[model samples]
Target: MNKQMTRAFATGLLAAAIALLIYLYFSPTQDLSVEKMKQKLEKDDYVVVNATTYHQQVNELARLQKEISAMNKVKPTIKQKETKKQTTSKQKTNSYHLVISSGTTSAEIGQKLEEAGIIHSREQFDEYLKDHHYATKIQIGEYDIQQSFTFEEIAKVITKQK
Candidate 1:
């Protein structure tokens, strides 16, 4: 009686194994594996990355942008007489509205300021940016500037706009 029962149990286990194999072989959906992942990628499909890594990358990007803006600040060199002259001329200054974008470099900003008659020279303005170590500190916004503003005043306005 013991030998007969052992034989029946072995047969049942073998049958179950065969049924599982057949089910897997005939299934409509393929099993998840490296092959499936590769195929999906080859089809130009989007895949999820680790959420923490993605968030870290985004935070790093924002931090870099802020640093860049702060590093492009302008420094001006002018004599006391020149400053007095500039101050006196400010009353007759023409107004201009300028828009600065976040990704714009210091050279571009200087060029724009020069074009608007806010600064004497783009090269000088660029040098000021380098000398002052104002990288990405220039606020990204719409600004109302005037031609009569001194270089120092313009720098302060551009860098500290609310």
Candidate 2:
């Protein structure tokens, strides 16, 4: 090829490349706002917990688990069992109606249980659900829960075991 023809071809290719770059730079695009991004994540069922809160939850869960293990190690005496049975019989009338939906969270369920006097601590219940991997397995339905039910029983019931 001639030198002038080669130069013309190179310049044309360079010009086309620059034109393409300019077109890409000037193109209209959809900008994702913070709220829109958050909404999109929520729509996709993604939860973003902060690091501090997540670490705190982990520490609290560990402490609660130790306490649970200690509690489990203690055996109830016959008298304690009898007393518990009597108290449970009396508390049977205290029924809590729990409605779990698609967007329900463990924290909200724990809070509701605590408010209904079905569970002692919301934090403990939340930690238990998270620790036992039942947080994501909770079924969406109406549950007739009694105060006499233990956390394990409650978890099983809510997870569709009952």
Candidate 3:
């Protein structure tokens, strides 16, 4: 009877010790100080409290800057096209037809268009045609182009001819 009591007491003490150890291991009372934070940063090479949020913000700012630059860049082209439209309106009221030959260079076509008052500037027309890859495809023939026709219409008219 005495041995049984001793064994029961030993088992209870062992169980209590195990429970105490487990509670201590899983407890959230761990110390975290500035020195510990610095040590963590050094160990991890770098540290950010909200890395993903910071990265996303930086990307958004870069995209906005790019969009602003693009908008600013397009303003000049819009103004130029508007001015050309005004000038062409005056010329269309008193323009004549000019004949163009096949295999004509883009520069020649541009010059003829300008001379016939179809466009405001030969250089501008040439640049436009070149940029659009239409310089080499202009059909050679007599065209009745006038400033009244939009550039788009003129391109279609020139390309539609065999």
Task: Tell me, by lDDT, which candidate is best.
Answer: 2
lDDT of 2 by residue, 1-162 (tens): 999999999999999999999999999989999889888998999986778999999999999999988777664565689998889786877889999999999999999999988898999999999999999999999999988888889999999975
In order of appearance, the predictions have TM-scores of: 0.41, 0.46, 0.40
Instruction: Point out where model 3 deviates above 4 Å.
Output: 1-92
Q: Which residue window of length 10 is worst by lDDT in model 1?
A: 71-80
Q: Which runs in model 2 stand beyond 4 Å of their true positions?
A: 1-89
lDDT of 1 by residue, 1-162 (tens): 699999999999999999999998888985679777767886886765668999999999999998876665432334566787777777567677878887888799888888877788989888787787664578888888888776666777878832
Better of 1 and 3 by lDDT: 1
Worst 10 residues of 2 by lDDT: 70-79
lDDT of 3 by residue, 13-110 (tens): 99999999999999899678978987888798885456789999999999999999999899989999999887776765756576677667767777
TM-score of 3: 0.40
Q: Rank the candidates by TM-score, best first.
A: 2, 1, 3
In candidate 3 the C-alpha lDDT for residue 14 amounts to 100
Candidate whose TM-score is highest: 2
